[model samples]
Target: MYTLAIDLGGTKLSAALIGEKHDITQRRELPTPASASPQSLEYALAELTGHYQGKAHRVAVASTGIIANGVLTALNPDNLGGLNHFPLQACLEKLTGLPCLVLNDAQAAAWAEYCLLSDRFRHVTFITVSTGVGGGSVIAGRLLTGPHHFAGHIGHIQADPHGPICGCGRTGCVEAIASGRAIAAGAKHDLRGKDARAIFARAEQGHLQARQLIARSAEAIAQLSASLKALLDTECIVLGGSIGLAPGYREQVEELLTRLPPAFHLPVYPARYRHDAGLMGAALWCEYCAT
Candidate 1:
């Protein structure tokens, strides 16, 4: 059976039609509407769903928000504030006339990568270091979601209690120091451009300030992975997202990680499905729900 997958990110809403083999047949993306209400985001998703009406047997969604108790909370960018306590599954089912499954973006990404790389490792940790740092795990082929459905919310793990303030108002969280947003902010003074790619490019070109900013960000991520390794002893840690997969960034992250305590040593790899991990993961969830 075919599945419809929707990935609701902070900046965009992407939808795709997927077959059982996990190949995407059709896809579309649109800017997420700027509103704080769940209704607003739902309207955008509803419009996108119309494009795939009757084309798939099931629907699944991966969203960038805190999901708990069957409700979506902590919609970021301040544009999706209305999503708090939103009945996302019910609303989508009503709009599309199909069964709907919702999973946190990080969990969906973990499942996608696990499906592709489980053969290489028995236990895996999937970390996405983008606008925010988020992560998930697959232990013995089972998705690891905690009681609150916030199991993979690793971005808030306190790294430095006095470093930088995160959007969540926490001090020195991993995301505050290592995410794409953090990288951009840290390089804003030396980098003339306002984009992450621009800052990364400058760092690649050996710009001293930009290089230091990138190194610092990479260090935070490596240290976090090291901590995870010491705790979970996972076989592999997979890195994805815009910043994590950047050409030179991964090497730098590895270098920093290698300098950590030997007890935290573990292999780190880039995500197999760098760009489409979320969509594929959402589709995987559709199959999971069907059974």
Candidate 2:
């Protein structure tokens, strides 16, 4: 079966046609609407799928929001403005006239990561530190979506009581400290207004302020990883997304993890699928469900 796999992120929308064996083809991408509203999302989806009218038999979506009973609502409203209560699955089904499945982007990515090492560990966690931090957990070989489909929303966990407020209205959320957005926002002096990538580049060149900003993000992630160890005892934590995979970033996080007690220092690995985790994960999940 051909699956029309789509990944809806904070900054972009991507779609691909996936063959039965999970090969991707005809992938396309577009910037997410500046003002993310229900109407804008509908328009975007239309434009994204316009060319593949008859190319797929089903649709699978990995999206940046809490997806419950086919409705999409943001845990952090600022990430997806005016997208609260959007009928995501219904809209996709209507748009494509195909069966549809929707899952949280992080959750889907975690499932993909889990599948890669299912023989090694029955418990796994995946964290993606991108524009905003996101995460998911798998325990006893089962993905935990929770009753509200919010089980893996780990980025909202508090990192500092006095830190800047998160888009989710929480103070000191891991997302506010550990995400790419946070890294960029934490810049000072000569690094002002630079994005996370630029800051990382500066850090490589031994820029003090840039290094400090990256270190701050890494520290938050290390703490978060330790907390996950205490809570889930996950065999390993897989880090993905732009910031998570950035050069030297994982090393920084690992070094900080070494500071904690031995029990909190779990093994950390980079995601295998990289940028395609969400798209491939959504496709894999839909296939599994259909079987």
Candidate 3:
């Protein structure tokens, strides 16, 4: 049997069919709707999955935002643009005529990363620094979803009391300082108006301003890591997403982390599945729930 795995992110929407052996095929990608409305998302999903209607036995979704009771609520309205408070599992089931399971993207990714190192560590923390900063944690071998399904919305943690205001209406959230969006938003002068990817390229080309911007993001991420270490004492930290895995980005984070005391130090590694972490994690979680 194959699981139809879908990842709904701030930047893109992707779907793939995964076999029992975990071989992925028929992968497809589409830019997420410019507008984050329920209708927009549903239409996009229909177009993205129409070709695979009956190809899978079930559907598994990993979506950005807070997923509670199968509904998605953007913690930072800026991240997801305040998607409608509708039941996502219900929508997917209606769309595909199959049972569906929905999970927070980072939580799903965390499960996928933990599965890769389950033998080595039982406590793992996964953070993604993409369109927005988000996280998931595995404590003693279990994914912590919390009672309200808001356990891993770590991106909203305050990074600077005086930092930029977040979409969540909070001041100085880590997401406001360390995310790809944040990087792009922080650009000025020669780097102004450039997207995160462009900014990163400029940073690599030795643009002092670009480099400084990314370094600031990395520093915020490092501080977030320190806080996580103190709070959870996680065995390891798994970093993912575009910015997190960009060339030298993880090293930058690690370098900043090294400046701190020993207790704050932990293995900071790129996600094993890379961009596919959320997809694979959703599939694995779907099967795990089935049994």
Candidate 4:
């Protein structure tokens, strides 16, 4: 049976048809509705999935938010705006007329990376530094979704108590410092109002301010990686998302981590599935749950 896999991210909504072998087909994307009202999101989802009607047996969703009891709550209001306490799973099932499974996007990506690297390592962590910084962990070859489904929310972890306030109403969270949004938010002068991608492009052209901004993000990520190593002894870290996968981003993170103690330094790898990690991961997870 095929699966309709959806990745609902802060900036975009992507859907795909996944065959039994997990190959994605008929993939499509739409800009996530600027309005965060439930109706707006529902309408967007309808349009996104309309083309694949009657093409799948089950539905899988990986979304950017805290998913609890099939509901989605945006921890950072900046990233998801008014999309709070949304009934994601029920909405998908209602739209698709099929059984559905839902999970945090980073969590789903973690599962996908873990599945790819499980033979080599039993403990792995996946970090996505997109509009926000998010993470998921697999320990002893098992994904940890936590009792409250908030297991790998490493982004909200405090990075600097004296830094700027995060959208989650906290101060100096990794997300507040390392996220693509954060990078853009921190821009100033000539760099003001530029998105993370543009900022990175400027950095590549040797803009000093751009370089510093990216380095700041990379440093926050490196510190977060060390914190994970200390807490979970993760064998490796898998990095993805727009900022995380930028041309030299991984190398920059690795370089910063090297300055720390050896114990905090672990292998960092790029996400194998890249942009499709969440989609394939959600599909694979649904299949695994069925068995």
Candidate 5:
């Protein structure tokens, strides 16, 4: 049976058909609606799912934010344009006419990555540093979603007590400093209004300020990695998302991780599924649950 996998992110929406073998096809993408209205997301989802009428037997979604009881509550409202409390699973079921399964995007990715590393590590943590920072962990060969389905939100952890306010109304969160949104928000003068990607390009050109901005993000992630190791005793860390997989970002994080004590040192590998980890993981979860 084919599973319709959807990845909902701050910047884009993607849907694909995943075969039982875990191969993906007919993938489609659209920019996320910039509007905060619920109707915008509904329409966008309808349009996205409309492309495939009978392509799959079940729907699986890996979405940003907290997914509890078939609903999505955005911790950082800015990430999803202020959309919160959206009925993600119910809406998708109605659109696709198939039972839906939804989970935190990063959590879903963590499961996919863990499956790949099952033979090597019993404990693995996956972190994504894109629009916002997020994380999921596989501990003792099981994915940890916690009781409230909010276990792996590493981005909300405080990196600096006096740092800038997060969109979630918290102060000094990792998301406020290390996320792509944070990187863009931190820009000034020449880099003002530039997105993270543009700043990264400039950084590659030897722009000192651009390099500093990215370095700040890397620093936060490194600290977060160390904290995860301390808390979870994860055997390894898998870094994902656009910023995590960037040319030098992982190297920077590895270097910073080296600054910690030997106990905190763990190998940091790039996400093998890359950007599709969320989608693939969601599909894998669907298959796992459906059977």
Candidate 6:
């Protein structure tokens, strides 16, 4: 069986036809519309669904927004143009006549990595430290979905009480200090209009400011990883996303992790499946929901 998976990200909407083996047979992508008005976003998704109408048996979506009781609360209300309390699952299912599963983007990515690694590791934590920090976990082979389906909101965990504000309006959250956005913000003065890629490049070239920014980011992630180790004792932590893939970042994170008390020791590694993890995971969730 095949499933159509849609990943609705902050800046892009990607759709793919994934087979039972987790291979993406076909895909489509478009810039996310400026206004996330229910009507406009729904129309964009519908257009993508129409392209795959009879090609897939089911559909699943991994949305960048928060999902509480199957409703969507876009992270940045201003950029999303205020899409609060929208029944995304119902709307998408109504738009396309097919069974649908809606999952938070991080949850879907975690599930994808879990499906790939659960046979080898019983417990796993999946973290994405990209544009924004987010995480999810599977403990003892079961996905961790809290009462409100917000289990892995590690980004919101307080990292600095006096740090910059987060999109969620929280102060000093991990994301506010260590996310890609945060890294760029901290380096903006020295970056001189450079992007995160440029900042990383400068860091690679030994630029003091860039190097410091990267180290600070790694420290924030290490602190969070230590907390997770203490709480769940996960067998392995899978790091994904753009920043997570950067060279030396994982090593730096490991170095910082070692500074913690010897008791909090768990392996930190890059996700085995990186780029398409979200889409594959959304497809896998469809199978899980079916069962």
Q: Note each model's CA RMSD in angstroms.
A: 1.9, 1.4, 1.8, 1.6, 2.0, 1.6
Among all candidates shown, the one with the greatest lDDT: 4
Structure candidate 4, residue pairs in collision: none
Model 4, 170-235: lDDT tens digits are: 899999999998999999999999999999999999999999999999999999999999999999
Candidate 1: Cα lDDT at 128? 90
Instruction: Report the lDDT tens digits of candidate 2 across residue range 1-291.
Output: 799999998788999999987899999999988887789989999999887899999999999899998888887666567888889999999999999999999999999999999989999999998888888999998889999999888999999999999888999999999888898888887888999999989889999888889899999999999999999999999999899999988888988999998989888899999889999999998988898
Q: Across residues 71-114, which tens digit of lDDT does each residue of candidate 3 receive?
A: 98766555566475757889889999998999999999999999
Kindly give the stretch of ten consecutive residues in candidate 2 with the minimal lDDT sum: 72-81
What would the per-residue lDDT of candidate 6 be over residues 130-225, giving only the tens digit for each residue? 988998998888888788777898998999998999888889999988888888888757586666788999999899999898899899999999
TM agreement with the true structure for every prediction: 0.93, 0.95, 0.93, 0.94, 0.92, 0.95
Q: What is the Cα-based lDDT of residue 239 in candidate 3?
A: 95
lDDT of 3 at 143: 91
In every candidate, how many clashes are there? 5, 0, 0, 0, 0, 0
Clashing pairs in 6: none
Q: Model 3 segments beyond 4 Å from truth?
A: 78-82
Off by over 4 Å in 1: 75-79
Regions of candidate 4 where Cα sits further than 4 Å from its true position? 77-82
Q: Candidate 6 — which residues are off by over 4 angstroms? A: 74-76
TM-score, candidate number 2: 0.95
Predicted candidate 5 versus true structure: per-residue lDDT over 1-291, tens digit per residue: 888899998778999999978999999999988885788999999999998888788899999889999898866555555578889999989888888999999999999999899999999999999878888999998889999998998899999999999877889999999999999999999999999999999999999999999999999999999999999999999999889998999999999999989999999999999878889999998887766
| TM-score for candidate 5, residues paired by index | 0.92
